[model samples]
Target: MNYHLFKRAAKLFTSLLGTTLLLSGCQSSPESIVEKITPLNPASDVVPVRVVRIDSSYQLQRAGKPYVIKGAAGVQHFEKIKEKGGNSVRLYAPAYADVLMDKAHQNGLTVMFGLWMKPPYEKFDYYDPKAVAEQQQEVYRQVQRYKNHPALLMWNLGNELDNHYGDFKVYQIVNETVKMIHKLDPNHPVTTTITDGVYAIPSIIHLCPDIDVLTVNVFNKLAQQPVRLAEAGWKGPYIIGEFGGRGWWEAPLTSWEAPLDQSSSDKAEFMQAGFKMTVQDQSSRCLGAYVLYWGNRFEQTDMWLSMFAPTGEKTPMVDMIQTLWTGQKPANQAPQVGAIRVANKLAQADLALEPNTDYPASVPATDPDGDPLRVEWKITRDVDEFHTLPQNRTAPETIPGAIREAKGLNAVIRTPTERGGYRLHVNVYDGQGSVSNNSFPFFVGVLDTPRLGIHMPQYRRY
Candidate 1:
């Protein structure tokens, strides 16, 4: 009996089990760890940006004017954002603060200026007085630089600092930073975002006295945001810093452990639900909500939660946000691609196809205003930053005439010669800049060999 072999087998089994649990949401790694106020102290004699109770509800006011933050997360499409009834944009960094402010002001929109902070996992130590003092000084400089800009709405101090730090000193630093900002620039309020709605919450509530608003960035549980806040007894005003479609962590998975995604319409429905739960519920503490990844991002999948496609094609979710913001639907609604059928059959999870096989794909689509619909099909590999390993993404693989669009509803797509996962995406456009897309993922080869029990050939009962 070899005890070393048995020990190695046990260690490998435990490691694999932990990884499985992490991926299954039953466990998480260590170190993964809100509101309000008045015109108290009158730090700068005049504070224009404030949260006011308006008819039993709360609204963020800027320059003594009622302001509901119809904000998007990204800053690329200011014109489209304005046209879609968005009045603000949230930035995560100050690199292009000047340019963004100019563009947002031109578009009749305000900006939620995000102040990037060093996470606890980073090089800086919040406990170190010198480091903290330097950060405070830098924050003051940045605030003074942009505080007078008309497009500046409020100061978002740090984004999800709790994710990596469970230390109470981080919030203390945030509190100090807020105090400095109030003294330097009292016109704008200060806020810090959280990934978890309720985390080290007591410390945040008690320690961070100067925080004006408690912003939360949520995903799958976004619809239950209000409930969670209430459960945590968080009475401070809050904004949905970011809420998108289903989060990749909890999304349904295929046999290959890849996350199954929601269709565009389904995503729009989730966004609507999120808005209803957080922003439109008429709660006094609810100010407004911002959709995450307003523009296209390569997170998990290209179509994960972004309102617009990577090619600048607007999805139905855009119209959903516009309607929610304006209380009226867009004049020209986008086409809806309800479902996609591959090879005249509906593949429940993912369609498995033979290499170099020809498969026909079609979508059921309709335009809202009875406009003519044009369906376009494209094929690409399922490799993405979130899902694929870094080593596996060495180079772009050739799809090899993967999809050939037909004249009408159907298109014939050829499977890739390589044995891997691929996707067939369909875009239904109304010829009026409104578009809806659906993607069907397919595997080009057989599943990997199933794992048997852990083998320790040299081990035996002692």
Candidate 2:
């Protein structure tokens, strides 16, 4: 074999292996180096705006009052959907312009109208001259037609084009299209949503100069958002154009493989956590985010849309989201606590409780906005009496009050009682009718070893 050919073959093999790892969802080498940079800290007193164009940066005001968009995909529900939280709806194409604009106007919700482009990821062949003229005409027609709608929030130039191609020609087309739209509708800004993790900030900034805000679709990796945004150096206004738990691409086919069916509980957990992480943690320059597939009948996996079945029974996730966005905990629902652990051990096993011994236990909880979470602790020799504790301590003494800070309800239980086997139980109430109780058995062995003996009488006494 030629020596040069062998080296090239080796390089090809390495590249293929890396791609395979990425597609297989295995850990791959980090794509870019992370550098420490100071995050922008907006003034504490600044009032949040839902969609405000400030200089070059767009600011989405944090929902002043809890607002939930009970929206559906398509132009059908424009007039009927109450949009309890905030009045907002997203429209996909010019074809639905009259229906959507009229319905949104009547229903009192703002619209994020998308400017549809041609099929296939490739750019219109500007060199062909015919393609360029066609694109310009199409763009101008769209800009002139929808510029005067009061429901319009921002103009979406395209949807998910970044995943298919990265040609500068496409960017140039988009840049020109945005410019035309701005000229026609200068009152509204331009935006476009990309498939998650495909577009780079620098490339768009350099190529698409007329674009105003950046929107991205994210699922599953919502927790790592701050780091991802910082690394991408996204200085413009941003929004989670799509988020929630398992998108069609994310969910597994069977529970045996990886709990892929997306249980109601799991979906609820995802919405709650995702909202807190995105809106609460990164709301400074972050504009509002939209949950994906608001109302599409996806034939492929039949799982991306947010509506219920024929009977119209909303999933637990929907109910959870209503509470989160509206800040009105349901009257019958409460926080749920699960995955409880004690001393780094699973909570199901027995634990040792001795004087001066630190009995740390972690209790994870989820609350569907109806009632505030109140955790009650109880300890007794008889497992039957585990519901009642020594001092009837129901309120949190040391637990972090803020849900974001506690990392999901972890606390250390200090036993003042003497050496003995005891059953410990944690009862969590959502103040609604919903309640969850967890129990664990622990043995407090006598401190016979001198090294482990309690020296202070106060520590030894129960």
Candidate 3:
């Protein structure tokens, strides 16, 4: 999950950054900020969203008051997001836009509708007049359709349209589109999602002047965003469009080139720390953040980047997020996980593994609430990256008949006979619906797999 937000701790940062919507040069103190700004638009009314300067900082203004976007990139669990103290949900596509808006509105959550710009990926020439006109019309339709919705809060013009791309025309398009949005929907502010790199800010500053806020879909360096942007000379407001731990491209991989995924518990710590560093700590100019997937999707494996499991069960990541968002702990906490071991060696394919052989694997984990832990085991082949992209995403396929036996925190798994890279997936449950998911990669082949120093470039995978 990449979508996220932080509205609960508004009081905590309001003192430090002055009040939201307290125009920088206004002759008022923090107490006067509310009186000057908090006007009401009652009865199903959605006031325009704006990014206002508060002296040296910025805050998002909604309904004539400060709004912290405790949001998610995914749309599932609107009720749960509200229950967990989130105030917004980002609808990423045009699919059932009105329906989602209704759900979010009913749940008392705001919506940031995302309109994707995919011309570059499809190789549609940016300079083509007919194509540009068609794209603009499509965007216009979306804006005109949902601009008046009471649940609508803001707009994400494009999601990560700047990774390994340098057309400059893309920035021009984003600028033009954002300008159009401001005129058609003057009430809502417009933001565009890009990769974590600050290198694109110069282009954004030069071309996309209408962008009110910059949304960075970040990984690996979640806490450093504000510092990086300031160094790159972008003084505008921003939000974390997607913060889902580390990217698969930046993950640690085995000698066989399979990535090592985090246990659910470890992921919890990582995500919690990231949220604190960015949303809670950097609220001066940072609006809020969105957790990547509120639902489940395949980035590398289901367990690699998702907060919820396929069965709608919550992982430690969710538990951690709930704790941060609401300040209340769950009755039963998810288990904390360590590494999986095979024959006394870490199950990272660092040792020799032979095909068709049955090996013992044990998981290391503990529960914070002293609950009993049960382990479930499954075997899956490594993801076939050849056929996977953001548009054509794929989860790892389970290999039937590979798991021979499963017991408490341990399993006897038979290596695949095909002699390829495989993973032993483990799920540790605390019996109270809380879980810790983890996996390790192992090669089924012999020494034919090279021991050469592996070098995987860190690319931004959105």
lDDT of each: 0.73, 0.53, 0.76
TM-score of 1: 0.79
Which candidate has the top score in lDDT?
3
Which lDDT tens digits does candidate 3 get at residues 259-337? 6677777777888887888889988878988887887777778767777778777788777777887888876778888
* Candidate 1 lowest-lDDT run of ten: 27-36
For every candidate in turn, the CA RMSD to the true structure comes to: 11.3, 18.7, 11.8
Weakest lDDT window of 10 consecutive positions for candidate 2: 453-462
The alpha-carbon lDDT assigned to residue 414 of candidate 1 equals 85
The C-alpha TM-scores of every prediction are 0.79, 0.56, 0.87
Query: What TM-score does candidate 2 get on C-alpha atoms?
Result: 0.56
- Runs in model 2 deviating more than 4 A are 1-83, 122-128, 252-259, 330-462
Over the stretch 230-305, how does candidate 2's per-residue lDDT look in tens digits?
6777666676776766553444321111112243345667767877876566666566666544442322223334
lDDT per residue (tens digit) for residues 330-386 in model 1: 888888777778888664644577988888888888888998988777777775444
Q: Candidate 3, which ten residues in sequence have the lowest lDDT sum?
A: 27-36
Comparing candidate 1 with candidate 2, which one achieves the higher TM-score? 1
